[model samples]
Target: MTPLNRKKERLDGLAASTAAPAAGQAGGVDVMDPVDPVGEAGAVRDAEGVSLLASAWRRLRRNPMFIIGAVLVALFILVAVFAPLLAPHAPDDRPLIGQISASTNPIPKAQDGFPLGGDEKGRDLLSRLIYGSRQTLIVGVLATLGGLAGGVTLGTLAGAFGGWVDSVVMRVVDVLLSLPSILLAITIASLASQPSQWTVIVAIAIVQVPVFARLLRGSMLAQRSSDHVLAARSLGVKRSAIVFRHMLPNSLGPVFVQSTLALSVSIIEAAALSFLGLGNPDDSKAEWGQMLGAAQNLFDLYPHIAFWPAACIVVVSLGFTLMGESMREALDPKSRR
Candidate 1:
């Protein structure tokens, strides 16, 4: 045979041999079995179910800062939950009323019944401190939830439907962001004809709404242009699914971190409002901020009254801040190493 015919024959024989089924196979090839052209399909399938939050949690498990923060937050929550059980006396009870005379020190020193001593009003200082954690937690969590609801709604609407919708929402956000957080909170608190615990919560929530909305909006915008979003679009996935499933879920990492940080800020701001005489109207209620506010005049004479609450605030805030920062690091791909 000529060289060309010989080459063609060799090629044809090679193709026939390749097409032949193996000894164990029933057919030429398993047509039903899906092809994994790149050899990465198994790996992709294994990883596909893992979400960002799950991955972040995995990272957080090994993170020392996260552990410390989580422990502190847990203790704080536990103290708040068991305030009634933990506290030796009722928050409003004044058992040592007779001890507070012009001759005797208004604030009592550590004694048998009161471990942390007594406040000016003769209420158990330790009891109030424990109960104050509950009040503080309530304000922080509720305010954050309220703000989160409003912020998420505005952010989702702005991001999912850009153009004029984005413009109007952004304008409102801008107006809110323009004012300083404390100033804004003060203004909102002032607007309330009756200043109560709810007033403080609402004020803080309003201030935080803009912060969360802006953060979520920015994250959403970035997600909207991501490869997965583009792929979903090309695959003719519904826009709602893309926004809700792909974009919003992916964008919440930063928001969650911000929420953690915001809790600390809310507590501090609540204290500030109370200090400014805009907190709960009830003088007998046990709140950390209110306690701090009440101690202002007595701060110089008896530092422990102010010191205890302030220290609690600082420690608790530090815990939340640490947790938030760790979460941010965990969520950031660049910080993974």
Candidate 2:
């Protein structure tokens, strides 16, 4: 063959040989063919979500404290909801005209139709406790919610838009933190023109806000630099939308933990305020703390009067605290191990 023709023929043959292998490879179902990396990654993410949920459930179920806490909280809620029906007598109704202090009168038992005994006035302790649950739960839950809302908003804004804003916000938080929370709450409560139930709630919420703000800010700061946040930002998402939709949702694990713990704190604070005469000033009100306060004068005489209310406070607060700890453990990625 001529030199040019031979060269062309050889080039064609090489091309053909390369094309044949490609076609053969395409026809052959190679079991070892490379997987789609994106699909595999998505599958891994779905699996991770399922596994995380399962782990959380397993951990919650296995935690005896969490179970106990849940049970206590549930019982309290039920009592509160059914207080009117379940309570044997009006919470504030003074049944006995004279002092019923250890008169050997047949005290009512729960099985005997009144399990919790009676106060000095012969008012039903069980009834008071049941009614008191409503106040405690209301104040605790509402105050925590207020704190959560205020803190998360401020903290997320500060962390997401760090600079002068962060400095200003954190400084405000620091200033609030400088004061003793109880003192501050008491002062605020005392200063209100007409303090009511909501005033106590507001006071507790204010005291709790700084704590929640600091915690949420820390979480937001950590999440702000995550890959998903960066990716969302790169997609031209609005700062507000990104902060609320992406950053906040991902950081809720920590916030939820803080919220649970904060509820317990708020409840205790409310009780303290009530015990100190700053909460629900109406004497006829049947709050647990108010009952305890009333019983303080008679503590030397009727210890049972204070015992039940104090026990309720301790049990409720402890339940929330324990639940918070368990939730924290369940939510913590590192703790999953």
Candidate 3:
């Protein structure tokens, strides 16, 4: 072969060898392959995008304490809602009046149709207990709602304005906080012309106002210094919008938890008021605390009368406490796993 032709043939062979390996390597793996969203890496991306409240809820659903608390709270609500259907007899009816003997058995023994027997007034105990759930639920929810409304207003004003406004609101809260809860409730209740269910609710609500106001104010203050709030301010967000939309919303987490805890406290406080004769004066309206108050005179002989109502109060309170505590833990960033 000629020298030029030999050199040309060698260059062609070298180029072919390089091109074959490059093509093989390009065909070996596809760069456009779709990712599996259900895989580990995808899961991590999803987790990173989850919201704080949503993450807290996810954790809450897994907690055994949360489950137990949820169940108890649900049960209480069900009982309250279905009280009319559940009570075999009218709560105020005293059909078992003949069964009672003041000197002997002031309260009737358990029997068919009347499983829990009769109270001091000879009213069907089982029916009264079932009906009491409704009253207790009402007091708890209304009191908490009232207190929350008042507290949120004060907290919002204080947190949003700061300086003089904060000092004024906090000083008022401090005064309320200084007073003993029960005594404060009593004083409020006494101001009313007559004792009624509403009196108990209002009294409890007033007593709780300070607690919620302080909590929300503190939370709002913390959020005011947070990155998101600062960013919103830098972006020229309106002052009112920043306070209500940003600060108020973020500050509500602790307040919500407090509301749950406050439900239990309200119930207990209602019972205390009732026991002190500040509850509904009408005997027809059955309440657990009222029952306890009426039965206190005969507690030595008919302990069961007081036992049933007191037990209901304790169980319901425990349910709220469990739910509130679990929620607090779930929402706390420090407690997150």
Candidate 4:
């Protein structure tokens, strides 16, 4: 036989040998399982490399600023949750009407039962501070949540369904954004018969809606042209799934960070509205800004009344700001060391 024929026969024999079954086995070669590239990449990225949350936690733990911020935030929340237990008196508690109305300073002396001091109205300062946290927390948390939800919804829709949807949503966002945040909030608040707490919340949330919406929109747009999104489209994956699952999830980190930071702003905004005589002036509720507003006239003589509430607002806002900065640093790959 020619050399070429011999080579061909040898190849055929090798293939047949490989294909033939062993004594107890079916016909097949021993094929090793293929590695899942996607899963492997996730393992590498998630377990060891750049997990957003895990690495953020690691970095946060290592950060002294984050520690301080976390502690302060924890304490603030504790005060809010346990105002009754922690406070020495009821938020609306006052000294005897005779003695209180009978004083020149009108500031309850920080002695006997009262510890921190008293406001112009004779309500316990410490108690008010403690209870005010609950209101502040309510406004901060709820307004931020509302804004986050609204922004995410609008931004996702705009980003996913470009063209007219994008234009309409963006135009609305632009209109809201065009006005200053405080101005927008004040304008909306003015529509209310009085600055009820809910009105303040609604106004702040409305002001924040544009900010968060723009932020999430930018994030969504950035991710829309990413390789993974295009790949998912090419694979004929459901568009809704790709948008919600693939794109939106990846775009949430910045929005989350912004939400935290905006919460701080939200609290300040709430306080500002109350300070401006725009919120419910219920002394029992002990809102920070209202306390400040009430004390403005008495500020010359009794600064502590103003000082305590201002301090509460500052401390909470500072804590959130610090934590938000740390989160931003941790989540942004470019900022990671």
Arranged by lDDT, best first: 3, 1, 4, 2
Candidate 4's C-alpha runs over 4 A off are 1-50, 101-103
Name the top TM-score candidate: 3
RMSD of 1: 8.0
Per-residue alpha-carbon lDDT of model 3 for 203-230, expressed as tens digits? 9999999999999999999998999989
TM for every model, in the order presented, reads: 0.83, 0.80, 0.85, 0.83
What number of backbone clashes does candidate 4 have, counting pairs of residues 3 or more apart or in separate chains? 1
- For all the candidates, what are their Cα RMSDs to the real structure? 8.0, 9.7, 8.0, 10.2
Worst 10 residues of 2 by lDDT: 101-110
lDDT of 3: 0.92
Local accuracy of candidate 2 as per-residue lDDT tens digits, 1-337: 8999999999999998667646766989433324856445655333444676678989999999999988988888888888889877887786653435355643333335557667766677887888899889999999999988889878887888999999999999999999999999999899878767888999999888888888888888888999989998899999999888888887777887889899888988999899988888875568887888888876885677788999999999998988999998997888886
Residue-level lDDT of model 1, residues 50-99, one tens digit each, is: 77778889999999998999899999999999999999888999987778
Estimate every model's Cα lDDT from 0 to 1: 0.90, 0.83, 0.92, 0.85
Best by lDDT: 3
lDDT by residue (tens digit), candidate 4, 1-337: 9999999999999987755434225435533223746435655433446556887898899999989888999999998999889888788877533446544657776877768867766777777888889999998899899888899989998888889999999999999988989888988998998669999989988888887888888888988899999999999999899988988998888899999899999999999999998888676788999998998987887788888889989989999999999888988889888
Instruction: Mark the regions of model 2 whose C-alpha exceeds 4 Å error after superposition.
Output: 1-51, 98-115
Model 4 local distance difference test score: 0.85
Model 3 ranges with Cα > 4 A deviation: 1-48
